[model samples]
Target chain A: MLNRYYRVQAGPEGYLPPAAASMGVMLPEKGEALVEGIIVSEEEAMQKIAEKIVNAKNPVFFPGPNILWAWNDSVLEKAYAVNDLVQSSGARVIPMPDYRPKYPMINPEVEINPNHPNLTIWHNHIDVCVFVGVHCHYANIALKIIRGGTDCYTIAICGEAGHEDAMISLRDVSIDTLRRLNDVIKSTGEGLK
Target chain B: MNKGLVKISPCFEDVMPQEYKELVEKGSYGQDYGVADLGSFKELIEEHPLCAGCGLALSMRLILASLPNPESTIIVGSTGCSALAFSQVALHNIHSLFGNQNAVATGLKRALKLRFPDEIKDVVVIAGDGATADIGLDMVMQSWFRRENITTIMLDNEAYANTGGQESGMTAEKAVLNMAPKGKNFPKVNLADVAQVAGCAYVATCNPAKSRVLEKAVKRAILAAREIGPTYVQIYAPCPTNYKLKPDEVLATVKNREKEGTYPTGEFISAKAQELFESLEGGSK
Candidate 1:
């Protein structure tokens, strides 16, 4: 059996809405939570990060869809070995699925979840119909088969250290990769875990 | 077609006929004839669209209907269904790139002011809360700071409906919404407050599901941006896909949100930026 498992840099910040919204409770702002740091406005900043990704000698990985959960230690080990194997086979190692968690105090307004899930599902509220599962039965299934939004996932390099994986939030992605991943997940019904 | 009928903009009318006036006022017709005649228009639209269905169609129509000129409105959008849909529309209309919708609209508005000072038009920045609150926050601020005459509408469908229903700033924290970091734990940085402080002259919120409220808010934003300067408006557009409910529930959700003041859905006249819009009549504003 494949015994599918996942890695966790941080867990998907699950069931966090009301506690975050309530007064006196200090939760991360929506903006601060999505990315590791304040949004980079200057091109130089993005360039600097991009350069880091390109220059990293170590293998790169994709973060989970969210911040709270990433993967279990065992699953992550498999992934790291896979990366090493792929690299040894003479395939160019791509720095992807890197995540940068925001730390509090230093960048206090939005703090990082020190303990998040293995597959931190990095979803977006603006586009992918978050209310999907509860409101409509066929939406995800129908949308998944078509390779629509949230149907697939990918990898990026933002804050992964060594074999540790993380998802870097890129503004856009390649459709080919998206379609391929969707096909795999659609077949399994596991949702890119 | 009824023999006594005189066509007036599909479902809406110019003047009320005594016999049919009540039917019209009572919201008789839901579908329209306008959609049929445009050959391959539906097919073409269906090509790249993300199944937003009629809601998005009417949304663009309503926004484009009063465009001083669609060509003049240089749209700036971040990555969302709205952006993709706008890209599809741009095939026929004049549009700029994806993302940076607010930034582009700001520059376009400034260019219009500098080049065609007297041309009363708009440069709309179409977007979603995920873009506005999460990614495009700074862009919106800078546009207002520059005092450019443009309008940016941040359509809040609660969650990040495009990249998979994740949490957004506009999504009330822990409202049983999506996979958020901690839900909006911190008080939402009141966007209107931020705009006012940033020197915006007008800010408003509306749900187009309520056509009158939407039209009124949009009209105000357009006027403010054209006459005075840049403005911001947030629309509570619901996402059944994310919410996992029927599309029509959007109206009820929006209404409840409005009543609770969780989502501020009204035209706000900011004192700074540029005084374009008249202070809404009375204190009712």
Candidate 2:
């Protein structure tokens, strides 16, 4: 194995003299390694180091066994780009976004003011709908609303299951997605365009 | 528009009574409950708007405080929910392009060691599986291989949940993790093995269900980083949606995952919990 490594040849500009070997590769006038008739350059060393770091593990990546979950309906171009860069830094990534938008679809069994119309939209498309500020969790339902399959749009989404309970369903990204995937209609008469 | 006499409230806190405002201070249920430990959850989301989901999205409150020093700290996030952790910080933080966290983290670490190796702050990175396994794998390998002195915690949920649960490199071999079927595949790359081979001497794996174990791992990683070296850990967190488990059944499923060794809680090979997971290769034979 060592012979294979040493047999690569460094001659003339590629040969490594004894003093140069002791000093960790003394370069010739060409600024390259002259060992076994083969030359190694500074740029090659940097690339090797870069490659090494790209494969190293143990940089503060994640706490453990967790992913960054999204609420669905995202382009994820930037996410993929970033992932391409960091895995080399030795951390893992996880996502948890789309567990379903907090749509305010109250159970019909519950007796509430039927006249109090729900004001929310459902969206599910390859693009963002409604507005840019709409949250992504609403993408699926927003898609549902734009299809006109149901009445009473405009509902709020809340964090689910014993978590904080509230009623404001305007996820930020639904608007642009809605615009892209469907036609834009005037919002409810409460002054929200 | 009339000269803007809209009469905004004096203190937003005043609109809500002290009791309601105190909600951010009081303790609340966490993983044990169907909800997160939302006392910090609300504060984090309120403070960091770009925050992502569930635990990873909102865990920054704990992570920020856990960092030995925050004021001097420069945070970097790769491609996962961890990226959102610092994203909300509109100031005093740096968010690098994805997959370069290991690289960025290395730069920060080297700059720090050169700058204030005496008394410096931590460089915490929130990375994801795809970022770690494929996209950023090279950078990660480089950092630990050089022993670049950083603390890395890998959150391995076995699938890519953020991008609608795509199959990541960490997904179990011959198991279905991605919701959309890419068909069954095998030979899930053992990140621990890769880390080990890449020269991560101090490595550990822990389950989020076991927070104490996780906390200890955090401490160990931090200490290792402080020693001017790199430390690696793989975390096994659970996902209610991707796991195909009901909301109520998440804990059991998480526990089951740990017991079944799909997530491999404990040390990866020779670190601390070796005896617990030595024959741990999921019977690939």
Candidate 3:
């Protein structure tokens, strides 16, 4: 018998629980380690993220569609937290251009092709790129390209599991997580000044 | 396509898009990528415009990740919500007419076979239920009957979600929508059974609620279509907008439906395809 998170009950016709249907198949495990390629506590990861943003000459926050969509009640709070972080850290917030037309228009100041992060980094001379509320798969694609072809450091503040490819990954991030990080960045930046 | 074609020119290295450069350096061209390898490597799909928590979008992401040969594969899409995301796919994809996906795949597969006879160029047709079960049922069935070496996958949202919520052939009986004001008159189309009868070498009915199951079905369908004949995989990708369900509620709804026996996941493989899978599994073991 397989252990399932959801309770299984017998139904009428051909319905079988996912565990039974997927017998002998190995499902991908959800990873909880906040940072990848290194072991660190959640507080340590947050400190590292704040330090990178505060120390960088030019840092930009790339907010993906999840920040705009009202998919859940926490999303609006997440967006507000991101705004607070940008304000405190003096980071430029760029909404990642999406195919959807109704949402935010492309920013004329920075032409950041979501497919090509290096171009944006090169054109704007961005030193650090912080990704928040971006879908996991898309973020993975961008992070790999940025790491492989650009000098800009990458940070991912994910709603779920941490990204293994990101330089500093804050996993299961909530509004509190963002607020705490923002406080750290403000203090760090003030100390530097 | 030659892998070197995407390589950045020495002179244009400073100007070429970083994505193309990364594709040459770390893309999943000849390598094997399963669901477990998702966030570790560069995915073929970029940011999509789909709704938040859209099951169709998640299904597309998982399907792309599960492709056995992403480099050599060409996707044939149709007019629907899925078409919007096709533009962002890193692999070569064609958005055909609303109901002409299989027709397009047939020609594309034949032409690619002629162009590269020795190479394996897998042509796949991915469309919505409205396009597959109703609009292009004839063309889709004919392709399977002819045993065209292509895979046909239906992103079954159960209604015409791209347009305002309209009743589609795949919509379940008694489901109220724009066209079906009172309720849908007929039960959902039995597309899986029809595919089996229409000479499909392998057939499956799955949903995104079971990502691993969906992944295995997609991988098997593509692999079977490579040598065996036509293949079909119907994925129940729920439409949160049209269904009036919250984004996060879609997966739970699918799970509830599965438990209630309204929608179940199963597979049907021909003897030849079964033999192929057994041999492949044995080798891997």
Candidate 4:
């Protein structure tokens, strides 16, 4: 029998609506629990990441398939805007391998999978890694690479709840949230100057 | 601020920044409409890597130029030799995974309509026969069944030309190909008739060598899709590399193959399409 399977539905990352919106969660009835957290709101986490970036010597940003999931021209512009906000703060932004990057921060040699060849090279030196809209599975692998190799701080900012190991799990992921976060960072950074 | 939640930028018009409105209207989201001069139209398609006299390339060029509203049209492609030429095509193009252009187009069309209800956006899928007829048959049928407003054009080169010319479901019987060393055993899948039966508002089978007929069929298909729902045009494009024929022989192969129950040309407008066309004509008059 020929099996024709296409990903008609979005992956875990695709299920996220904006943080302010209510959505029914789809859970597996008979599997090990996938999500566990301290229940911090998404906004507080963004502020903390902003503070961390302001203080940290080395910070890296990893963005995932959320851009592709949105798939609208306007959505793309928004994604780029968020990237710009992070970039202006002097953070090294890396795009998910599958997603086309607006900037050249993503190491094309490194893929999103666990066994990427460049993962070993980036495993140790970074002080903090801020994950924005990365899939739960990839986020876990990234944690493994960073935690196993360095005493690095990890933060997750996402629409859905999954990254159990993140020091701060900011759960609200919507474009509105990014806009507010951008405003705060822009003001604070400019205030310091 | 929802610090715990990581928010991305919103592209939805309601949430997107105001400055982007002008960008969307200025054809930044899609490609410019290349010149429409017949016989010697300026090429929207730059030089491509396809073999010389590749019928699929010719058909794509014609279809790209015949989009009717290239500025507002988004072309979705799937994995095939046809997709290889997409990078060079000036129009806003997307290459989704193999065998899923229809599904992608369905989502894209619906999204565009939702975002711009006042504007007319054309979502067209141009894919190879294998993607449309074999692997993507289910999605293609589903889109037609849903009556999605989109146009799908299949550049049918008979076999799976990109993957070393393997025998596809659309491969003609007795045609020897990679996997069918002893000649293909089954007849071509009746995709045009399938589209007709599946309630596609307009269906046509044309060849690139007959540019006028192909262009008319494409134009009609696009126009019909605006009001009459899904439309399909399957062009009999030949693969010279796969067919083991000289580059110049591609046109003749499509033209002469009709005697063997292949490459039938003409339009098949459903009753709904006919009604829609009449109403449009009446309203204009």
Among these predictions, the greatest DockQ belongs to 4
Instruction: Estimate, for each residue in A1-193, the C-alpha lDDT of model 3 and write its tens digit.
Output: 5443322121211222233213222211233333434546777877777888888899998777677433445666677788788889888865553322211333334435456655567678788889887888778766666766666888888888767657677777878878888888888888887
In candidate 2, position A19 carries an lDDT of 25
Provide all candidates' interface root-mean-square deviations. 26.5, 19.0, 17.3, 10.8
Candidate that beats the other on TM-score, 3 or 4, i.e. the better one: 3
Over 4 Å off, model 2? A1-193, B1-65, B89-93, B177-182, B268-285
Better of 2 and 4 by TM-score: 4
Expressed as tens digits, the lDDT of each residue in B1-285 for candidate 1 is 121221222211212222223323322122221222223222212234544432444455555443433434455667776765664442122344444667777666667678877655467787777778777777778888888778887777767777767877767766555566555565555676687678767887676656666665676777677767777877777777777766666567667877888876666676642233334333343
Q: Write the per-residue lDDT of candidate 4 for residues B1-285, one digit (tens) a residue.
A: 011112223422333222223334432234334324543434556467788889998898788767777757788999999888886664668899988899999999999889988888899999999999999999899999999999999989988887888988888889998767999887889898999999899999999878878887888799899887999999999999888989889888887976565667878988877787677656331
TM-scores across all candidates? 0.46, 0.46, 0.61, 0.57
Kindly report which residue stretches of model 3 are placed more than 4 angstroms away from their true locations once superposed: A1-193, B2-5, B283-285
- lDDT tens digits by residue: candidate 3, B10-92: 32233334554576677776778887787888888767888888889999999998998887899999999999888878777
True contacts kept of each: 0.00, 0.00, 0.00, 0.06
DockQ, model 3, C-alpha based: 0.01
- Please give fnat for model 2: 0.00
lDDT of 4 at A151: 54
**Cα lDDT listed for each candidate:** 0.45, 0.43, 0.78, 0.67
User: Who wins the TM-score comparison?
Assistant: 3
Model 3 CAPRI quality: incorrect
lDDT of 3 at B241: 88
